[model samples]
Target: MSTTPPPDISFEQDALGRLILIAPGGTRHVNVHPAKMFPLTEKDHWISIQSENSREILCVEDPQTLPEPSRSLLLGALARRDFVPIIQVIHRIVRMADGHQWHVTTDRGDTTFEVETDESIQNLGHGRLVIVDRRNTRYLIPSVPSLDRVSKRKLEHYY
Candidate 1:
């Protein structure tokens, strides 16, 4: 059996710099968000262009298949939307009755947040780690081996 290719959806910003999704379905979807369907694995593929009202304007299988201008526009929006801080150092981790309060220094700046469970700390296949706070803010530890001895020692208790 054979499968046909996906639609050729065009994307461009309006006069006010707002994303416009010109879907093959002929609807000009405005206020669209280019969200990755599988960010961890297919970081560049399987994108869902949705509207402000949660309507799917287009489902792109491979961004590379789209026109360069449209692909670049969607990729730029996805980069801005998924802004997870890269944790550089673990300053402190205070264990409390309900959860642990983490004080870490990220590439951006210093930050503090609470982790409700050990499950919140996920291993992203590689040495990379992603810590999700109680409020659902994600912090990325790019590499475990890249951290200093002191920071690694502080994080070992939970590892």
Candidate 2:
């Protein structure tokens, strides 16, 4: 079986901190963003670069295939775009008029956020859960079974 070669693309950050894509043959696409096709699963592979209006500019199968500065630049952009905090401890969950307010400590630090509804908490199976806050920020619970007793009890009502 013949494998498709990686896209011949590179990246550059402008003075304003916008991601610029340098395609093959010196074609440049300015102010682009790298979005992971499989962000929750195969994060490092299958990235799509999109324009300001979300138009697909190019698809990179693997950032590792790209040469030096390009690979680093692409990975850096992906890091800034995908920021899902891993919840380590659930301090408290208070019921609000609209939804529930969650106070938890994540891998990043302590934070409090509101969940608009039960539907916002998604179960990805195998004890993996994703809690999306009202602002659309996501917090990941990699393994429900691995959480402490107190934390598990706090989440029992949801699951």
Cα RMSDs, all models: 3.1, 2.9
- C-alpha lDDT (0 to 100) for residue 41 of candidate 1: 70
Q: Count the backbone clashes (under 3 Å) in each candidate.
A: 0, 0
How well does each candidate superpose onto the true structure, as a TM-score? 0.84, 0.90
Model 1 has an lDDT value of: 0.81
TM-score of 2: 0.90
- lDDT for 104 (candidate 1): 91
143 Cα displacement, candidate 2 (Å): 0.8
Look at candidate 1 and tell me the lDDT of residue 62: 83
Error of 1 at 72 (Å): 2.6
Q: List lDDT for all candidates, in order.
A: 0.81, 0.87
Give model 1's TM-score versus the native structure.
Answer: 0.84
Residue 85 of model 1 has an lDDT of: 86
Candidate 2 residue-wise lDDT at 41: 81
lDDT of 2 by residue, 32-91 (tens): 988888777887788988988998877888789988787888888898899999999999
